[model samples]
Target: MVEPIGGASTGALVPPDDYFDVIKHICKKYDILLILDEVMTGMGRTGAMYAYEHWNIKADIIALSKGLTSGYFPVGAILTTDEIVDDMMEKGGFAHGHTLAGNPMGCAVALEVYNVIEDEGLVENSAKMGKLLIQGLNKLAKRYSIIGQVRGKGLLTAIEIVKPGTKKDIFPPEMDVNHLIADWAFKDGLILYPRRPINGLRGDHILIAPPLISDKAVIEELLELLDKTLARSMFMLG
Candidate 1:
């Protein structure tokens, strides 16, 4: 089992270039079932409709949620190959002992949601805006010494924080440091997701995922607000 792209646990940590390729090769060699947890990286969040597409690999099982309903309704789904389904059916047909198994309302919402995502080209938008976001952050990193690293894909992205000229040297946790920029941005009407990815103790970073439909202008405004927020945080930390 894998996360494809590490989600909240690692703050959207994307693995090395060949990580998935290597995994797929190993799985094929060993004839092992590959499972992907796409709860956070699926449904166009990672710009490609599915993060696995970035590696062009196939998995035996894929779990999806969150974006499946776009927060309009609480729903989730699982996808698997016909081979697996046929095997399961032969072994007594499996059991579906959970609620919402086939709720017509949820099915309808999911259908409409899928159509909207396709019809509106939100997947392409996420890819487009994601590139703009990364480019903007790379430029901002040049100005802010506190921004140690910028990473992530599509609408799911994050920035690592560090003290000047040092890698992984974060501000004292007691200062509520990781969240300072988030708070500053909030006051300026922008929301940022702050997280402590290093053992959930000392390390600090902020996840920034704009709406899938955000345009270039919205991203520019976001970058400007983020610039101001970083400036305030640097001053306060210094």
Candidate 2:
């Protein structure tokens, strides 16, 4: 399974330009099943209705949740090709179901969520605002030497915090720079998702996922708040 935008596992990491294309080629060559874990990057999170759409990837199966019901209701879904499902059905059953499987309310909410995304032009907004997000984060990176890298696709983005003047060098893990940055920002009312890019063991980065409905003005205010947090972080490092 793969996260098209890498999600929290790799700190909103976007694969290289050729990575997905190459993977698709390899999967086709070997007749391998290509599955995508789109729980975080789906439902218009990665500037597209589905992150795989960015690469025109043909996935055998795709997992989705979170954005499906916009958190108004709990729901999850799996999308697979007819070939796969038909084969499973013919072989008896997949035996994969939940107690609330196909619950009416959850399904209804998920459908409305998609409609809202379209009506609000959130997908388009994500693509436009996403560029601003990356640009804003890059500016902060330029000012804060501790910021090692800034990356993401659409609103699903993050910054890798590093020891200043060292190429991708991590600080003492006890310092917990990721959480420190997030905590600092939280005090100012800007919530950030902190994660260890290196498998929860080490490495510091914070995921910044602005709401799809966010406007430029809101994003600018967010960046201003983040500026303050980074300054505090710099002081702590010093």
Candidate 3:
């Protein structure tokens, strides 16, 4: 299984030149069943209709949620090839169904969400805004010693908080740096998702996923607020 965008678990964006494409090649070579968990990256959150589209590789099964209904209602879906469905049907008509599976209201809402996304060209907006967001974050990284790295694709992005001016250095766990930053940002009227360290027992990172429909001005405002929030948080930390 693979998370196309990596989300909160890893600040690393799946670049075309990186592991995602290589893993696709390997999975095909070995006839492995590839499952793409696109819960966070699906529905144009990553600039593409699906995050896998960025790699131009297909997965045997794809799971989608979150943006399926734009959080207007709780809904999710799994997509698979007809061959897979046929196999399941032959074995007993597929053995699973949710209590609210195929509810007309949810399906209708989801359909409207798709229509709105397409009509407003949200996917294209995500791509454009994403570039600006990354550029702004990189600039911030240069200015802030605590910002170790900035990485993202489309509206999905993250910044790693680290010890200032130290090589390969991360803030100690006891600092709760990520959570502190998030709390500060929230109190300042911005919300961010904090992630714990992927390596060792401690590290600090925060995920930033702005709405796909955000315009340049709104993004600029977000960055400005973030800048203030970071400065305040660092001051308190010190």
Candidate 4:
């Protein structure tokens, strides 16, 4: 079973420590293989080398990409225990191949990326900047009627846009309020992830994942732009 630490598509984050404890225990008891998909949350983006490390749970397998080469080169990796490798070898090797399977250039670039992350302490920077981001977003939530929930972990965060004065009163799909806010932000020189309807429902959310190297000043500037954008969107929607 594969589970993502912070769901990139949905913009929802699973609680780190306790939640994984139960999952790890259940999977162990049932002799199930636990696979962690860290493609989005890996390589110091989530304030750690891997988000799963925050839970201290060992997965049977892990998938990694994107941050592997810091987007300089396309590369991905799958990791598993030695036991699994031995079993696969006995069964005539694992069945998987891609055009870039053994690209030496990609591997070399990925290694350099790792060195940069470690040498510059990007993981710690992510944690610090993430806190600033959450604080700023929460303040915006209090000030803006269109803002609903503000939630996320590390640098992965989300804000749900809804009708004013209602907890879960999502705007109708046709309104596309989330998209409007994103467009306004973009025009103001801030690029955010595209809006998404929650669980195919009317509720809309936008994800905010700044680069791991971002600082508190940059996050504050982002909040300022977002605040202006939301105000404009709310007036237009109303």
Q: Best candidate per TM-score, number?
A: 2
TM-score for each of the candidates: 0.95, 0.96, 0.93, 0.92
Q: Lowest lDDT 10-mer window, candidate 3?
A: 196-205
Which residue pairs collide, candidate 3?
Answer: none
* Residue 47 miss distance in model 4 (angstroms): 1.0
Q: What's the CA RMSD of model 2 in angstroms?
A: 1.2
What's the best-to-worst order under lDDT? 2, 1, 3, 4
On TM-score, who's better, 1 or 3?
1
The 0-to-1 C-alpha lDDT of every candidate, in the order given, reads: 0.88, 0.91, 0.85, 0.82
Off by over 4 Å in 2: none
The lDDT leader among the candidates is 2
The residue pairs that clash in candidate 2, if any, are none
lDDT of 3: 0.85
Predicted candidate 3 versus true structure: per-residue lDDT over 131-221, tens digit per residue = 9999999988887878888887899999888887763487777777888889889998999989884563565788899999999998999
Candidate 1 Cα outliers beyond 4 Å, as residue runs: none
Better of 3 and 4 by TM-score: 3
Residue 91 shift from truth in candidate 3, angstroms:
2.4
User: 140, model 3: CA deviation in Å?
Assistant: 0.4
Backbone clash count, each prediction separately: 0, 0, 0, 0
